[model samples]
Target chain A: MAKNQSEVSGIFTAGSKSKPSAAKPKNPFTHPLLLGSIFPLLLVVVWEVLSRLEVFPAYQLPAPSVILGTIAGMAEDGTLWGHVFITSYRVLMGFLLGTAAAVVLGSLVGFYKHAEALFDPLIQAFRSIPSLAWVPLFILWMGIGEPSKIAMIAVGVFFPVYLNIVSGIGGVDRKLIEVGKMYGLNMFQLVRRIILPASLPSFLVGLRSGLGLGWMFVVAAELMGASQGLGYLLVVGQNTLAPETIIASIVLFAVIGKLSDWILKKLETRTLHWQDRAAKS
Target chain B: MSLQLERVGRTFAGKPAVQDVSFRAEPGEIIGLLGTSGCGKSTLLRAISGLDNAYDGVIEINGKKVNGIQKTTGFMFQEPRLLPWLNVLDNVTFGLEGNREEKQKKAGRYLESVGLAGNEILYPKQLSGGMAQRVAIARALATSPEILLLDEPFSALDAFTKMQLQDLLLEVWRSYRSTMVLVTHDVDEAAYLCDRIIVLRGQPGTVEREIAITESRPRERGSSELAAYKAEILASLDLTTETA
Candidate 1:
């Protein structure tokens, strides 16, 4: 009842005070990003207070300041860049390889009945197996090196990208294809002009999900035996019983993962600007 | 270009859609294929457009057999099938083959002719239904196809918008002089635009009747001549109970 009354009052105040010609600027407090930060900030404050009071063991759950100090120490030592660089390079390489392979195989299966018949069943079967299951086999074949690690992340990225690409191509509207035919577009022209653009939204969706999987598999990849990477930092922190290092490494992973996903999200928004999506309220 | 369909028949899973449908559209003539739903009016139109070639007989353009989609043919579908990703200018230039500058210039001219001069950069999602259809018309005319096939192109628009586009189509015909085969169920639309109207009927649709409109261009929409023609067309179809 209070909420409803407040909302009603809010509308009346805006209607009476705000001039239509002025185009009043929006309230910064109401911005989604600002609103989303509130809960995290509150939780961190509470956790910090409780840790300072020694309500929880410091070894298992370090205070947020301790984690930040550990990260600052790593930066001072100049070893932070090496770990970040290696992890990012491995992910980028894996993402590219996985995406390229998916596009080729997915287009083949999507476009040709024979290819779908021959390959789809096998691919689907492989997809049902746990992605981590490939770790042992990959390690055996390529050894506990960058190649095996990169290959592990690539395998994790492949399935979602491949599935989305195939479905995207298959889901292209027949009417649009007819428009291409009416224009007398040949097989190649049809695919280039019609099929490719029509399926791009789904393909971008695939890329985002595939990037998520790449991040996940990087941790598994580093577990195989790595001397560098944030995943390696997690192992080192655990072995040395430094809760601050572990917390710092996890925080770094969160920050980097969010930054990369934000970049891809921006790309998706720009590319699909023409889409008639529902307006953001 | 002249379009000829001789005993053209099509079947879907052993169920015939159109059979023994024969007609000839002379160069620069506007021919209307009129029929109720399920009479295969669209099916016959597809065969002539060469989008469907599994039909039983021959569809020829300029005395040459149409084995596949022909470059000289342009088709406007029931709904505006503009690529959503393309802006109005790019959609109009879609089928044209030329340098980018030439294509853009040609598309701009056609867009201007279609009363969409300032909407060049706007995407299809930004346009009203009438505006989108105008872009479709511009795209069709940009190719300068010798024969244009229209499948109830303005049927999805409002009544007023529909009339406006019908006039726009006629104005385009005057300028382009392209042979047109229009598939429509509207009696008034047939009387207003077509030089000759072919009526199709039955399960496996065939040519039922052919009516020639002797009235000249710019015929009054509600004039006695057009009203009489509409009555005649309705009577021929025996559609006393049917409503478009």
Candidate 2:
């Protein structure tokens, strides 16, 4: 009765114990996380050396040091936080809105044939439209305001989440559903207990991809017209011919994008720990 | 509760799978539907469980006709079919209806009865095939249904594990006494566990013979009595070659 049920010590370790002799203590050097960064570190070192040697013009392509300096200068002036904050805020709002819409529409279409026939073709048609082509129309409709910017990002986020939800629900094992039916669960209980949890892995995959698209659309949104945001800095760097400023913004984008994705990946790992996966080699 | 299946028949896309399958399971009786592959043993079990209501005749439990899945019946599929997301304890409690604490308490007892005590924290993915099937059996019995239907529950297991589970099932049945209808192709399994063996044969299977097992509880696995029954069931199935 007093057991700690939440302890998940061996949760993610299954079906990979085929070779007992292969179960040596892991080598730190062979660790995937450590090994993955080496190539990127090498590239940075090469870029730093080449720029210092004046192999590239500073005006056209600045050194990594210069871009770091620009970023540090912005941080000192307090503008860095504001740009990062506003851009992230836009993406967050758009992500929430798009995810909500996708869940509603996707569940309906996935569960019912009539809903699929009624809405799927139209949604598919809209998906085929180039995301960038919506920029001018969105700007004209909402007048280059925060609404238009958020709306643009929402459009980008919607398709992936929607499509993934549909497929996820469709891909649910019929045998699992039969189990629910055998238990005499009603339709609502069946959906809540079986369908929702079964499709959750794909849903989370959709969320991560949707978030990535949200970041891409935020760049497009701010590029069209914006007073504050990292995307706006890209335009200012271009107009003022400051390559370091442009590169600094790009670096910030990469850092923040990777950071957000890392959070989502952590969440995915925690929730899907029950999945029977191959050992990480 | 006694179960009665009267002239039960099922067809898939105009092709008959089982026809005129009539049988009755007395209260606390273990009835085995024994057959070779494609003999519609599972089809008949499904119809009796009310999972397939499109069958040609009436299936009644306690004299009331079955409409759909019966609240008084529990079913075990060939595969464990444990929802991978739930741990052992939760999977055992999945079909139970009650307060959380009560459900867990009942689930704990059933898990222990199936010899899976102390492993409640483990998930289905971590369980070996036999262990997973033990959890499935625990889950099915947790509801304490008056009737339990099993579709080749031990068919996927290793020979040693299969024998151990067969004994475990009989042990559980001694206490719970749920009228069990087991569909199995294993001649030894049917002979070892059943009170009556209904041998089904051929496509669109129907009951070809019913062999009564009057040897009583705690019958030895490889006893001459059970071996004779196995031979009889095998002979009934081998007749399929000529009938087909």
Candidate 3:
């Protein structure tokens, strides 16, 4: 009987006995940096092998080494740095302008029924038109200058940010709003403290997507106009029929996209640290 | 501060939820509004807290008619409802009126009082259900409001945790001496914690009965006197002693 009782007690205590240990820090080899590079490196190796075998026309599909050589030459003369700097500056400026406007307008629409009725339909209609379709009109109106390129990028960035902000604000728990009211928070305080923070994770998602679109729009804008950027390099390479230059520009675009996304992901993890803890415990 | 509600009635979609409910709670009194589900006890608490202003009649706090959300009232929902993004200390200090130092000091004291003295930096997600509710209680108390309104705050807890929280609540009440109106569905909980229990029954719930417990504080949980009060409340709700 004593043995049976011990067994029963042991069964009951099983869960408590296996206490959760603290999470061990990750090591370099197991880090996301190493893991994410594997596929890209494999693809590069395959491309270089195929190029050496002359699987495709060498002039059209230059070898990875040739692209690297072109990149080296551009770097030697400071052309690559200039292009990267100008493109990054334009994207940053346009993304900020677009996202700021969207946050303000989207918040107003989400918080008030009158604002939703007035603004939502118009925004929805405009958003359906392709972003590239605006390039010609913007170039005509603002001329083929920096203003036109920035405007195009801003237009591309706006829709996703606006939609996500509105939905995020709308999706905030009603119970939370009631808690805010119970504490005697005014309308503004309720939004600032409760609504905004609650919606921030969703807002960050919008920002990341908006940023990607900002890069795409800058390319389209630069394709049309006089500029020294990655997009201009693509146009110049095509005009000169230099496949290495085209391939080099494409590689640069991928690198910049990955770097910017990495920065945003870091910011997301920092801001939403509570979510990670919640998921773990 | 005192709370006075006269003929308080609320209607949604032309159907009355609470009709002609009247009660008055004096300063430092612990009153429990007892009922089954759909009995409008929760609705009445909401009206008293000034969250529902479309109700008929008047709710007066310290002789002043409350038209909107009252600053002197601290309300606790059934859920702890702590913002997940904030730490325990920040959650407790939320909505407080004072500057940073005063709010932090008050929040620290309240957290300590709730047996969470060393857990000020913990996030709500890291806490167990009972601990989260305690943090909610601390948040409400940190404001130092004259009246504390709680709606079924301990119903979701396990029996042991519920009992412990009940005692903690009584201890807090004894020290703070603030007017408290608790809405609950548990007979033993109401009887053990309340100085006066107001029972509600039927749809469009109105006050059916009022029983005042003159039993002294620190009374034994299983004492015959408390059991008698519980029996009476159960009977008023049409629940037999066997089921209770």
Query: Using DockQ as the measure, which candidate wins?
Result: 2
Instruction: For candidate 3, write residues B10-76 as lDDT tens digits.
Output: 9989999988888999999999999888979998988888888788988999888888888889998
Candidate 3, A118-173: lDDT as tens digits: 99999999998998998889989999888989989999889999999999999999
Instruction: Report the lDDT of model 1 for residue A63.
Output: 93
- TM-scores of the candidates in the order shown: 0.94, 0.94, 0.93
Worst 10 contiguous positions by lDDT, candidate 3 chain B? B235-244
Q: TM-score of candidate 2 restricted to chain B?
A: 0.96
| Tens digits of per-residue lDDT for model 1, B124-197 | 77676777888999999999989999999989876877888899999999999999999999999999999999
Per-prediction DockQ: 0.31, 0.47, 0.35
Q: Which ten residues in a row have the lowest lDDT in candidate 2 chain A?
A: A1-10
Tell me the TM-score for chain B of model 3: 0.96
Off by over 4 Å in 1: A1-24, B240-244
Q: Candidate 2: where are CA atoms >4 Å away?
A: A1-26, A31-33
* Docking class of predicted structure 2: acceptable
